[model samples]
Target chain A: MLGRGEIAIVGAAETTQLGAIPGMSQIMLHADAALNAMADAGLKPSDIDGVACVGPMMPQQIAHYLGITPKWVDGTGVGGCSFMLHVRHAAAAIHAGYANTILITHGESGKSRINATPRPPEPESLNGQFEAPFGPFGPPTLFPIPVLRYMKTHGVTHEDLATVAVVQREWAGKNPRAMFRDPITVDDVLNSRMIAYPFRILQCCLVTDGGGALILTKSDRAKDFPTRPVYILGTGESVETNMVSQMADFTSSRAFRVAGPTAIEAAGIDRKDVDHLMIYDAFAHLPLYGLEDLGFCKPGEAAGFIREGNTRPGGKLPLNTNGGGLSYTHTGMYGMFALQESVRQMRGTAPAQVPGAKISVCHGVGGMFSASGTIVFSNERP
Target chain B: MLAPGRAKPKPTPETKHFWDGCKQGKLLLQRCGDTGKAYFPPRPFSPYTGTRNVSVFEASGRATLHSYVIHHRPVPGFTPPYAIAVVELEEGPRMMTNIVECEQTPEALQLDMRLEIAFTPMDEEITLPLFRPAKGGR
Candidate 1:
């Protein structure tokens, strides 16, 4: 078992300009975020001894771009939540004395497609054989495959789904960096153009061009950094099925149920101890799944919890305070941004900061609920 | 004319049996020879027990609509508002497919509706097995 608070995030940052960047290529976005994070921590790239990142960009590519020769490297690209898993791996590596300082970067030209490598699995791959042939356009169509079954089982309504976007947009209003800051309502969400059945354009995540990075090191050295260190209390990562049709249950994610409890238990905290939450909202339904799977609310109760304004601004729990992928910038791999938001909230510097928030849980989903990573963060050392 | 942008399956050594069976208008499923557990998207080895002793068998092709989406986006070979669905085969595995021979509307694509397999030959090599609403004949 990993020791609690053994690793600390010494630095965290996103690309200087998020949303749409026509200038920076994908790798430059990764470099830009890396340098910015190094700057935030008052450390040069030379100080870093380890590197990690998602692919189609390799860890060595990120290390070379920033002029660092790391002793350890990680290219564990599972999906959007790969960065959370990176933090977990980085923590384990540090605890095992693999490397001292590790930098994990994420950059995707999801919208601009600038120098972006097309990463389709081989035609003979599992997805190509079983899923791609169905002509499911993309996440809009593919991710929502289980929605009808979930809604039918849970009694979650279109209005209830619409309310998720509405509530998150309310949080976005306070954020200048948020792409869409204007207030929206359930009516506005329902009235939006349909992308797929039961999913409006407003309900889907934004396809923006951006990147973010995080730097991790032992907690002992974290206090020496210029920026306030947010302790990595615990982490858990898991995967269920790459194919959405094969999800163990349509109503809940098997990965989420496993990763969330493991991290919370590792952190040695009860669900009530969490002061702020960031369950990745790549789609409106995800937060609902995240809430119930994480045990923040009972099954079938998350929609009502959001409708009651519990997760809205100034409610009992402030969720997706950075507006999430729904209104915040989602650069395809959105886990890094969620991690950055959790750090900002713990640091008491979030634009929509929650007052005296000590413990925050950031949960993420990758590839249509195929994988999950849960990381518990605390401003106070354990 | 071949439909532009419609992705076709590339059969592999392990999955060739499934595609070949589809060409013969049979929905073939693999079962663990040891445990007799049936599985889909064929594999050389049984997912259960990690046993290579697996047997292929023709299924009844009868299924129930487990879940689906009425996709409005225009993809190649498909018009707006098509039902991309997941159907649970009576033998016990769920697979992604298109619900065909019915109006592509939410009101029509009811969950738990009975469906039967229908093979559409994309080419000489690939015959995609789709699901259509079952008639009164069980």
Candidate 2:
């Protein structure tokens, strides 16, 4: 849990534009985000001693461009949740006296430039050869399979999945940082061109080119910073089977099942006490599975939960207030945005701030539900 | 002219048997000798006990359609308006397959619909396993 020792987010920063920008390289975007984040925390580049990054366009290149040598560097390539996992690692590193302050950074130009079109390494063994031959290619096709299965088992409809996009778009309309701010309807989603079975164009996330960064430090050190501090109360991470074929349940994510309880317990608070939620929304169905695995809803009930408008604004649970990856800019690194949103909410700086939000939860799912990371945040001390 | 290195389906040794079995109209699953658990996408080691020496067995042709989705768009190699389903075999393993020979609509896809295995050969090297409504349809 996060409360055992003091780890607070003293600063957070993001690039001005999230969509396509042809002028900037990946490293430049990351450097710009890091500078903005450092300014937000009222700190200097020299203050950073540790670095953690997700699957950026070029990690070492970014480090070189920043010119801040970190004593500890973690480049965990588990996809979006990698940033949340980095936060957990940063907290431990700060606690262990390995690094006093850590900067977690991510940047991508996936839309603008196709960097390093290196050939994929040949599968080392026989089993890898079998599955790779099918041309699913990206996450869009891979993730929908389980969601389809979930729909079949629970009698969930495309309309049910469309509701997620519609609600998130509503939030995006309020968020200036979101890529798509226009309001959308269920009919719009249903009528959109189909990419995979049951998943319309609206159900997929955007391929944005953007950057984001977060600064983490010891709790006591955070008090000395210029801004209000948001503490990290608890954190959990788990990995399921890598291959989609080997997953135990297609509809339910094992990472959430394993990490959710550990995170809440570590925070030392009842699940109901958490005031805000930030579940990853790479695909619209992700948050549904996350909520069910985190015990917010029972299995096979998340569809009904969304249909009743519980996750929309003014509803009991206001999810993805920053528009999430669905309507917001995914940048292929949504976990960073989730962490940044929670930190802002806890600091009372969110555009759609929850009234007296003292506790919050942020979750990230990486690599075809192969990995899950959960973190609990609170204003209260243990 | 095209380059020599391009996208092509290649089978690994572990999955080769399963593909071969599909061509032969047999659904093969691995069963752990120690735990007596049936597993899909056969693995050399057991997921339950992490024990080695897992044995392969021919699964009963019978299965129950656990869940499915009606894909309106055509996939890379698949045709338009196909039903992708996850069927739970009688041996207690679930596999991804397509449902055919039925109306591709939600109302027709009832949970726990009894289904039997059907195979569609894509090319000389690959054969995909699909399912269709059993004789006495549910």
Candidate 3:
């Protein structure tokens, strides 16, 4: 597993501003965050030897745009989980002597649609042929199927899901950067206009434009960095069926199950060792699934776990303290922000810092729980 | 406010028969001869065994609702508040479809409710297979 603590994140930063950028294209945001991270690390773009991003051939694009000619590159775009996987892949590449320093960047102009990239509509693709014909707009249309099924089986009430949004908003109140900092109640969530049955507007993430970047190098060389290093204790990534129906089980994400356990096992750490957590909350039910699949709670125990305030601020396990994608900034794929928050918390520099946090776990999902990436980090090496 | 247009699906060689069967008001299941596994959305090779020795058979059109969501957003061609459903077919494979001729509500669209296949013609050459509450519970 490249031995725990082999790689460390030496620099991390998001674009100076988030939300509603009508001028900057998506790629420009990538460059902006990359430059910001470079400045934070006190390293020029030329110092980076590796680059990674989501989608095909993006590593080459971001690297060249940042004025870097990399020896190694990875473009592992598995939906929102892509950046999390990029970190895992970059760490492995570094350990394998493929490169010394790696850069990972994420940028999505989700709301503004400035210079937006259009994905080809493959009508003949399995999902296009089978699922899309049924008239679902997007995740809002499809995700509720699994969640409704989850509710019936697990006895998770509609209000229980609403509580997920309420609690996260309470945390968001402390984050000035959060898009929705106003306090919300469970009634607010339940009464909000329904986008899909079982999902209100409050349960869904906001549409915003943002970008983030990270730099990683061997931990042995990390002390020279300008910021406190967040060592990579372990990472795991996996993918499941693209069509949610084909998911082996609707109530659980197999990708999350695989990735979460692999990371904790590789790190040789138990759940108790985690001082902070970030489970990508693209929707209210996601954190519920993430909690169970990642072994943070027993099956059917997560909804009540949150309702009781276990994950809210001042709770025993403070999760998504950045307010999460639900109340924070969600620039389409939200994994990058989750990782960024984990880095900040581990360094005790988070906007809503978890005091003296030494270890943090960030879990990400892509394409309706179709893919998952889990990473464990620590400010201290075992 | 589902946009007033529906995205059409194009069939490939592997899936042509399934679409053709839909045209004839029949649902088809792809069965792998080697593995005895019947799968949905027909393909050339077995997803489990990777064997190309697959053939199609008529499905009974009986299914039970697995899960569903009532979408209030605008789907091109679909009005607001329609049920998008996944049904477990009698043959055992689940299919993503829509529920027609029933109230799109939690009370009406109960999980594990019995449903039967229904078809909607998109255009002259294309017919979509959907589901509705089955008569007399199977």
Query: What TM-score results for chain B in every one of the models?
Result: 0.94, 0.87, 0.93
lDDT of 3 by residue, A1-382 (tens): 4989999999899988898888788899898888999999999988999999986338888987889989998888788878889999999999999999899998889899887776644788988888888887777776667987899899999999999999989888999999999998889889999988889899999899989999999999999998999999989989998898888788999999999999999988999878898999888999999999999999999999998989988888999999999998998889999999999998889989999898899999998878999999999977
Q: Categorize the docking of model 2.
A: acceptable
The number of the candidate with the highest TM-score is: 1
Give the CAPRI rating of model 3. Answer: medium
> Whole-model Cα lDDT per candidate?
0.92, 0.78, 0.89
Residue A258, candidate 3: Cα error in Å is 0.5
Worst 10 contiguous positions by lDDT, candidate 3 chain B: B1-10
**Which residue pairs overlap in candidate 3's backbone?**
B1-B74, B2-B74, B2-B75, B3-B77, B4-B77, B5-B76, B5-B77
lDDT of 1 by residue, B1-138 (tens): 245567888999989999999899999999998899899878888887889998889999999999998888888888888888999999999999998888999888889999999988888889888988999733
Please tell me what DockQ candidate 1 reaches.
Answer: 0.88
lDDT of 2 at B12: 70
Question: Which is the better candidate, 1 or 3, if ranked by lDDT?
Answer: 1
lDDT of 2 by residue, B75-115 (tens): 46555565656678889877666677888676787768899
TM per prediction: 0.98, 0.88, 0.97
- Distance from true location, Cα of B6 in model 3, Å: 1.2
